[model samples]
Target: MLVYVVATALAVLFTYISVVYDKTLKDSLQKSRYVYLKPRIDVWQKLTLYVLRVASVLPLVLVAGFRYKVGTDWGNYLRSFRSVTHGKDGHYGEKGYRFIQKFVAFFTSNYIWLFLLCAIIFAGFYFVGIYKMSINPPLSVALIVATSIYFSFLNGMRQGLAQAILFFSLRYVFKRDWKRFLIFVLLASSFHKSSLVFLIVYILYGFKIDIKRIIFYIVIFGMVGLAGGQLVKYVVMKTKYAHYYMSAFADGGFEWLWFFISTAILVVMCCYYENGQKSELKGQFNVLLWMQMISVIFCLISATVPESNRIVWMFNIGQILSLPILISLEKDKRWRLVLLVLILGFYMLATYIAIRGGSHRVLPYRMSFGGE
Candidate 1:
């Protein structure tokens, strides 16, 4: 627990310093040819940013990759790695991840290499995405730590890698480049079938939302929720690739009150931002708002169908960017600081509950390096 706290603090501090230096460079270069040619940073700033980036990424990689008997899926992943090493079939149609495991197993029998490679991929894409899309990079990194989405890197390895890759699609999304966006979506889906649902984000990117559409979606989601596990059961039964997850219906006790509260907060934030700001990032906010709404619907459905939360998680990942973007929308310095404090406070509370919560399966951290 102390280790986790220290790692989290160091991540926030390094990322904050990096963002501060980056913003200074951007601000100073506004009128220079360097701004138009490239984001020219002085040698010192470049070195500082690179060091900070490493500081921000290394601990997460170490913790996620070296952990032993940690995370709910640790045993499952270990079995799969061993199976692949023995030339046996593993993974349920997630060929991309299976191939990675097999390739790593060829070089080393230990599954630690698999975890390390996945962590590198996850961190590379995740950090680059946050750097590219966020108006406030430090806040975005803090949110990831606070929300404990980092746990997904340690547990849901396949989905974590897929989600990180999908994060890159946001660039194509805002540019309206359908071909590029679809390519990334398809690639992500190859890692985790659930990621296929994120393809809808391309369509929702530029969609104009109004009261009527909101009400219509709410009604549709309500109807699906009322169907309980039946709807999800039917879908799973029909989809050959997902049939393995059919047993998830046996325990239909997904609680989504937290998601509901989060959705309400997002709705209010979006409304406030739309009424006030005319920033370039408004389009990005719109895309995030629509995704959040979709996430809310999935969360509602998950209340009845436990397996639906996988889909909810895919969409909820947007909050890493959305929440920070929302906070950045505040123009007044005082109000912005206030909002930042409130957000950090709420996230800290959420992180505490997550670590203590049964479903998160993230407590009592154990590492292979420690002889666990």
Candidate 2:
């Protein structure tokens, strides 16, 4: 528990420092005396910014990379890594993940290399994703920790990689780069077939949410949810995800916690609605709104078709990303601070519950190579 606490604190602190550095550098460079030296100063600023950003992400990468028997699937992943290293057909994970396992095994039979590489991939994509798409990157990074999404990366390695890739692909979605977006979706799907669901975002990205459309989506998805279990069973049976049908996930149940959290964020956004907001801000908010709505739909489906909850994660980025945008839109400074504290406090409490729950088995953090 102390391990997680310290890692979270360090990640948040370093991220805050990076944010401060950016602001301070920008302000300092705007002076008339710095005009002649702008080129040199700009180069230095870019280098320093890169370093700070890397520092902000290093704690998370190190903690995740150095773990041993930590994540719930630690043993399972090790078996698969060893199988690949021995020139056997890896049977545990997605083909893309297996391919990477084989590629790594070609160089070293040690499984720690695979773990470290996966940690780097997860951290790199997450940091770069939030950095590119988030208005408040620090808040977004903190939310990732406080909401226990970071732990998910430690457990669901392949799905985590897919999610991170899809998260980064959002920038292309906002830019309306169809070719790039499709490419990324295909890339993510190679790691986890569930990520293919993200392709719908491309088509629905332009939706301007209104009461009528909201009601329509609710009705449509609600009906789908009613038949969710059977529907998912049939669809997954046709794909590599067929095994989920026999797993604990097939017993459908609503994710009340996720429902509440996602709905709360959407409601908060609606409460703080501003018609006079900047076009760029509005655009970003609108895209995230659709992402949030997708989360809501899957949450509804998961109630009766629990396996669909996996799909929920692919779209849940909006739940965290939307909060900072709302905060930025707030006119009252004190109220803004209040909102920030409430959201952060709520998620921090969530982190305690999630860690204590032990679903991911990430506590009692132990290092690899048989160290405590």
Candidate 3:
């Protein structure tokens, strides 16, 4: 536990330093300097930025990937990997995940490699998205840690992979590049079929809808939630993924209430910014707003549908970017600082509960490098 906390603190510190370097680079670019010295300084800053980015993600990848009996699914994944026959037709997981398992099994037959590869894929995409889309990268990174979403990824490997893929694809969604967006979403779906649900985002990207109308949609979704379990059962029964839902998993119930509260806060923040600040990123705010609404609906639906938290996360992951982006919109430095402190405080408390809550089963961290 101490190691985990220390590693996370180090990553957050390094990431903050990287953001400071970014500001320095911009400020330096406006200064007049000797041509030779300027280029050298620019190159050095860029290299430092790259290294810091790697440092920011390294702890998370190592901690998650090198785990032994940490995540709830660790044993299940290990057993599946060992039992899988190479070069055989099987529907063990989504095609992308199955291919990864097969590739790992064919060479070293080590489950460690499987975890490592998935960790790399997830961290690589997730960090890249945070760096590109977030206006406040440090805050975003901290939020991700505090939310325990990174730990969640260790357990839900397939869905994590898909979510990371979708994270990258969001840029195309914002750009309205339908072809690229569709391609990436399809790729993500190959990792987890539920990722296909993200395709609806393309239509919602730039569509103008008032908040009242959005509320109406939420009401309709709440009604659907009343029968969500039966609805899910009916659909799963006709799909190959039925086995996963065959046994009734425990209802998430109020487990997802925090997401709803966070989403509401984000919505309010974005609306405040949109109405007052008048930034150019208003379109991006709208996109995030719609995504938050969708996430809220999914959260409600998951209340009745067993194991639907997996689906809820697909939309909820938007918070990683949404919250940081909203915070960045504040022009007053003092207010920004206050918001950051409050959000961080809340996140710290939430993370403490999540880790101790045991639903994620990530406590008592173990490593595979040494004897298990």
C-alpha local distance difference test of each model: 0.75, 0.78, 0.76
TM agreement with the true structure for every prediction: 0.88, 0.91, 0.89
Task: Report the CA-based lDDT of candidate 3 relative to the real structure.
Answer: 0.76
Q: Write down the lDDT that model 2 would get.
A: 0.78
Per-candidate alpha-carbon RMSD to the true structure: 3.2, 2.4, 2.8
Model 2 RMSD in Å is 2.4
Best by lDDT: 2
- Residue 360 alpha-carbon offset, candidate 1, angstroms: 2.8
Q: For model 1, how does the per-residue alpha-carbon lDDT over 265-334 read when each residue is reduced to its tens digit?
A: 5666656655424767777777888777777777766656656667766777788888777776777899
What shift in Å separates residue 320 of candidate 3 from its native position after superposition?
1.3
Question: Tens-digit lDDT track for model 2 on 72-173?
Answer: 888888898888877898887778898889888899888888888888898898888888778888889888777677888788898888988888888888
Top TM-score: which candidate number? 2
Q: Residue 288's C-alpha lDDT in candidate 1?
A: 81
Candidate 1 global CA lDDT score: 0.75
Runs in model 2 deviating more than 4 A are 32-38, 42-45, 212-216, 275-279, 370-372
- Counting clashing residue pairs in each candidate, in order, gives 0, 0, 0
